[model samples]
Target: MRISDVLEKFDISSEREDYATIHDIVESGIVFKGTNLWILIFAILIASVGLNVNSTAVIIGAMLISPLMGPILGMGYSIATYDFPLLKKAFVNYLFAVVAGLLTSAAYFYITPIYQAHSELLARTQPTIYDVIIALVGGLAGIVAISSKLKGNVIPGVAIATALMPPLCTAGYGLATANWPFFFGALYLLTINTVFIGSATLFTVRLLRYPIRFLANESQKNMANRWVTFIVLLTTVPSIYYGYVLVQKENFTQNANNFIQNESFIEGDYLLKTELDANRKQIRLIYGGKTISEEEKTRLSQRKNIYGLAGVSIIVQQGFSVSEINKELSLSDRYQAEINRLKSELSHNIQQQDSVIKAQKLGGQLYKEIKPLFPEIDYCSASKQSFFVTSGATRNYTVVVLGSNQPVRTNRDLARITQWLKVRMKSDSLKIYIEKTAI
Candidate 1:
């Protein structure tokens, strides 16, 4: 058997549906009214809620049910076939759907009590070159699925992979919260997804040799081609810049991590935590055991260049103590400084004592509230804990410790409990630890 003959066995032409059937399917989906409009609205709301609470399952459900793909696919198909009327209709309906989705999600976010930006919401606020690739590949897969006789689960999978709805909802979130950065970032990401997906569809449609509906003269064809090219380029060039920014951020983070893990250590003080802020190009190190001298800090900062962090700033903070204060002061000055330190320590001690008492009371109240829902929970306690975060800062989190007979095995159950705690406590920075008791 020849190589060409063997390759022919894998040809997709045999399984493709009729061109007319494919055209009808694409055209039928372009209209966003009645069922499709309602579905898009509901999907947007669901996605917003998912982002609000950071629920992966809910977000996936929203993606699966979204009807936003129709007009995007239609736009691509019309461009490929030179169907100007269909393109206009698709563009109009696409605008309508986007407006409706944004409005619905914005309304939900504006009225919701939980206003914190969860991890899921934050994820959509940035678009990298990788997102462009996903959108393009997903568009290709979507067109192939639509053209095939046996679609199976490809369409829904493509819809989820392309992720058209979440970014829109995220932009709505930015609008409701009056967070311009979030709004603009998410909008840019949405543009990336939209432009690339449509571009991919156009490429695939041309590759499949879909019949052109409008028979035009040479001048008309050139004009139409110019418009399409302009639109694609207008959306694509910015995405390339964003992709470059993303690459720079990833490299900074990697270098910071390497420096912290291997290079950042003091001779006398013990490093407790290290925080990296890629956006600010800063690294902060916290020491607990002892104070670091200015000379040591200077030496440490000088080593940054060796780890590919020449322009990055390094900040070092040490545990506070009266003994760590400068010893060059006179006796009177030293005494006054010691007295001030004692007063500050006393005040902090009293505040910490009060916080502990309040935590105990809150823990008991939460246990009572959660007992009925999770009968397996035998004990619960809540307290405040300090930790370093990605922004080169320390944060205080409400930590809940739970003792249960059976382990919380499923992520759904864990997420449920976490969401409940966050809402009840009105604390976005909350952590839960479950300890398994012997059966």
Candidate 2:
């Protein structure tokens, strides 16, 4: 069947009369206006916190909250229905969402005390063909949900598929870190998502048989053929390039993973994370192991060349030993330094907040009762506000009591002390010690 005739049978675009200027795209659409910017910002903040805490739940929450899907989806509808003004509006709205999401996340990360990079952010920095697949699948599903009757809990599915928040957060990390690779990789992810989702939506619309009116009259159909030809050609070139690049990436990853898995060095001796940037012809290998002997290094280099990756650069660190691995696991030097810097910040803030004294008193009272019940508890020092103790089941507890006056001279004190000690020991074992109780 001819494409136009097929579309007519399907009845794709439900004709709406009030379609006007670009602004009307949002002003008239289902998505509420005026709140787009705020919603985007709020989603970014949630995403930023999620990345910092390494919490997937929070990240997904952010994705569900993101206002990004609207404008882009609107763009697809406009193009499919041949609403040029709405298309322009949708395009502009999508741009605003991107910019707003980036800035909001960047500002949050820039000011936050946390400096550690979470898995979510790191995962976004590396764009693979897998991400494109996800976006495509997500786009198709989202459109299906929008158009169909089975629209229950589509937000969760969209969260998994679209992955809108991570890239924007990565963009923020890139800007804050001044890491060009992060910046570009994140940008590439956003680009891939846009292309796939936009394409998926277009293809779905076609499948749904959306009708489009040729600007030319039926008598002038021949004249409109050139314009159609130009449009198809223009769209097909980029799509072809995108597909080719995606395929190349998949091939590279498969080859790289196979090579790594087969390598002798990887057999229970090391854990490796490989990142391949096909465009840059670079592969980064982060692995834990002892330093390779000269012979082993030579073998590795030979393997790289054999894999057609001769120009790739490698950085190897020896981290097989317990101490070295511990050091490697430590937060980044910069992050630790920042934490130390916060001590002064906390000290200053503590003086301004009255909760410090209350905290100290709680510590004192808790410690005072802890000493008498567990003989293993050790109290090395105490003041009117707080006390300290060292206790372990293996050792007799040494308890030091700190109070403004003296220890409570009653059975109530002993009972409370016993309860406190049992909780501390995580056992109900019998033990008692009346170590130095100072006034």
Candidate number of the best TM-score: 1
Per lDDT, the best of the predicted structures is 1
Which ranges of candidate 1 are over 4 A from the true structure?
A: 319-439
RMSD from true fold, candidate 2: 20.7
Q: Mind giving the per-residue lDDT tens digits that candidate 2 earns over 63-162?
A: 8877677766676665566656666777777777777777877788788888787777787876765666788788887766666544588846786578
Which 10 successive residues of model 2 have the least lDDT summed? 380-389
lDDT of each: 0.85, 0.63
What is every candidate's alpha-carbon RMSD to the true fold? 22.0, 20.7
In model 2, residue pairs whose N, Cα or C atoms come closer than 3 Å (at least 3 residues apart or on different chains), thus clashing, are: 375-397, 376-396, 376-397, 376-398, 377-397, 377-398, 378-398, 379-398, 379-400
